[model samples]
Target: MNVMSVRRAEASRRAGGDRHERTVWPFAALVAAAGLVMLGYALLAQPGWLTGLTLTVCGTNPTAPHAVLLAGVLLMLAWGMARGRQTAWALALCLLAWSAAAELEAALAPSPAAPWRLAPLGFAIIGLWHGRSRFRVPLNATRLKQAAEISAFSVTAILVVGGGGLFMERSHFETPVSAPDIGRTVVSMAAANPGPAAFDGPAWQINGIALLSGGLVIVVTGWLLASAPAPRPAGRAQRAIVRAMVSHPDSETLAPFAMRYDKSYVFSADGRAAVSYRVLAGMAVAGGDPVGARESWPGAVEEYCTLVERSGWRPAVLGAGPDARLLWEERGMRSIGIGDEVIVDTGAFTLHGRSMRNVRQAVHRTERAGLVTEVIPERQLDPGLAGQLRRIHREWLGAAGREHGFAMNLDAMARGVHPDALVAVAMAPEGYAVAFQRYFPAAHAGRNAALSLDVMPRTPLSPNGVNERLIVDMIDYARSHGYPRISLNFAAFRPLLARARSSPESLTGAERATIRAIGLLDPLIQVDSLYRFNDKFQPGWNPRAVYIGSWFDLPRFAVAAFGLEFALPYDRRRTGRAVTAGDPGFEPLKGPAPVEAHRAVRH
Candidate 1:
């Protein structure tokens, strides 16, 4: 054999080895299919004969009609299995369970017991061979040898018992045996009575039948219970479903929102409520009347108020309609400017002007510093890096005090609530993480994305130009990824910020009075300071107001007693002039300014 021939022959041998290794399971499956076919024919065609034989030997019929139906189903399943259908294999296993039960009942039966004497042994062989394929077991001639052994043992026990019973019966009839001699008989004989024995004497026939039937039932039940396949363990998706069902009230309560039916607000155990501000969108999609959509807001507001009253907690609501604000006022709930929603046109956007300047500078600086920004697919985010980014988030939270930063960012991600969004992180030169943002796709009438940015903690640099830089990076990222607009959220207490920027000369008399009254009892200065920080971003100022169906329904005494600092602006549609904070119209009741002094306040 030359080297070339030798190599070719060796490759052939290796290929053959692989083929042989893969054939074992298919071969076993073929054997199992053959066994199932035989069992099916016996179950469907000869069920009565089988049952009669079982009753004759066992003294009662234990096979249920459902068992026969299952066997037929398994035959169909076997056909599916022969063609390599996994679903068919699973169904076949279930059918096999019923077949096993029937077989066990036959084995334990007492009448005409000859035919089914081998039934239990046959079924046990099938189960051990096919069902135990996945279970570790020896596969050799030994399995056949074990079946033969069981058959031999079964035949020997049946022959001995049947022959011994016949011998005793024959002996009883052969001669007129004396009473003392008959008393020693293996089988019991009835005692002679003074009067002729009643023609049909009670023989404990029902009791014997009951005991035998019960025994067969217990044996069959035990075998079925023991042989049934254990359920496969839950996977990732199953685990997630369990968690959502058990722990998330928001998921359950807001299911209507998902189905685009109704909107709701859910309160968590921690006094946090998640209110859907765009509940009307879903109603609109369902072809609800425009007037009905308008009417839904008041009811939603009342429900939220009820939840607040019941839970004794308050949380911010997003994308609120005009009616929601009015309802908040009616319920005497305080409003604040938390953040703004920034929507940018992805296709129309260009990196230019003052808005684009900061981003431009940051990009240049980052490149000069040898730090690179790459827009990669979302899945490419390394797990280790993602974990590190989360740590940086914790650090940011620690520095800012957990109460001040965005509440939903960390909690939402931890719960795996938002799975549909794409996320990206920016890394510094030393591989230290700098920032991360999550983008949620648009829903309802809006086509926009939401971005969250956080710089590394303990960095002494000001956040002044950081947001614009992040926004630019995000916009660039989005443009490359084919996304349209981005929405930057506003603070809940945005009115306070609007108030601080307003000149006193711009206020009306009533507006000024309200502002003075609110400022006297609340931390107007502190709120003003916070709003000043958000104003630096130079975002488009959109003053959104709350709407109420009836202001009279509010807790007027509570509002008066608490002297709530911020109140939602009352809308005067004709002038488009909103009653806001810092309006000079404010005249303190007991201050140096007289009541008439407030009369001159005008916008």
Candidate 2:
């Protein structure tokens, strides 16, 4: 699709109308102002004052308990409707219909505030109905169901528990109360603000009950309102299709990663090319180049870009190679060199010179320590040894979550899944696997098949330079096996950092500052250190970058990218096993590594 058609299609899909997907914010502002006015009237007209900013806004009135609920509910709906959610629009319509009837009745009764209230209500109801097509974004079915279930359960539990507590403590009330009065007070307090009921003494107990239960409901409600249109990730069938597309020999080295289970894809209309991405913090991060025929990339890019734009997510590309960067930059994206893909031409690679002295010595030392390297094809792997590789991967991860890398890391360490993959395992004379490297076939030119490193992991108790030893041995194996090249880790900022390290005096002031800033983060990401380790191989460095649709997207893209790479502290795990430093059996498993996502420096 052309860019214009792409935009129209996305706009039509999101809004059911093809003008644009701009959130109906003018209507949101009007709705919010109406809520504020209602709140102001509640506070000023009836001085049923409660303490604090929150209570003062949603003041109580026994004669109009619905007003307390309506004001707060309108404010919450305004936030959700601002996201253009159809659910919010639907809920607002129901509330508006009831509110309009009430206002119409009051207006007939000659109340001064009635006309004022009816005008905004009338306008809001009319505006929402007319622009309903714009609010076409559907609520996530799963989240919507959870919200409904919780809402129903909360109302029941609060009414039962809170009503029982209030009636039991009826002696503490300033005045006598009935079952109906107690019910209204309990329900109102449990949802919006405090009820009209007064206390003879402290209301702390009631406030605490409301807070414990009500706070949870509010959080759920907020989540619903803030939600964006979720990406429809590819299923098994789609992945199989993507696998076929990525199988083309001319595909990018990182294109195969597009088949990872966590991703969503946008295919060209011709079904020949596709872009895969994952959404984080409303940022759509595509890992690498579009997968498939070169000529179809434009359509894939256009569709992907337009889809994210329509869904209200900022689009970013992580670890995009040179050709892919141009594709993104042509769409007006800003590209920054974030890393380099290291590749050693196995035919030319050797540890013969003085420059390979460190690597050669490390290999010798590890071998002397009774460790030998062995290559096992994916189909030939022993089940027990495959289990050991997984153990090594988990142990090396230590305190980190398994959300390894969005671009280079495949999170694949098992057998049977990757038919052509090769596992380079380092074993002790005792026969246990101590360290290993996993390689995926990623040949591009008509030359011999090259391999890309997916995982490099080992026990911390293992000897230092294990990764280097693994790399050297793997290259030797590949050279003999007809694979003429080996792709190693994607070392972030290796190009400029290596330049600065070898020629510090040549760096500009800005470059020095950038290096220093990156150095500070090295303790977390192993940025410069990983680059230095890769540099020793004297491999060819191909540039890779992160591309942002706009400079404003940098903040979201950076935060999401970093979070995905290093993982957040509270990353939840569904597995039965724990991997934290403090978990049982952790020290023996991972050694005495400190808290970090990836290991520091040495690896």
Clashes of each: 38, 0
Candidate 1, which segments miss by more than 4 Å at Cα? Answer: 1-349, 354-359, 374-380, 399-417, 444-466, 480-483, 491-538, 544-603
Taking every candidate in turn, the Cα RMSD to the unseen true structure, in Å, is: 28.5, 8.6
lDDT of 1 by residue, 38-113 (tens): 4443466646545554432223442333233333343444443333333344444554455555556665787523
TM-score of each: 0.35, 0.72
lDDT of 2 by residue, 445-539 (tens): 44635778887888866787778888987887777766777889888877679889789999999989989998898887788888888888989
C-alpha lDDT (0 to 100) for residue 452 of candidate 2: 82
Model 2: lDDT equals 0.70
Winning candidate number (lDDT): 2
Worst 10 residues of 2 by lDDT: 591-600
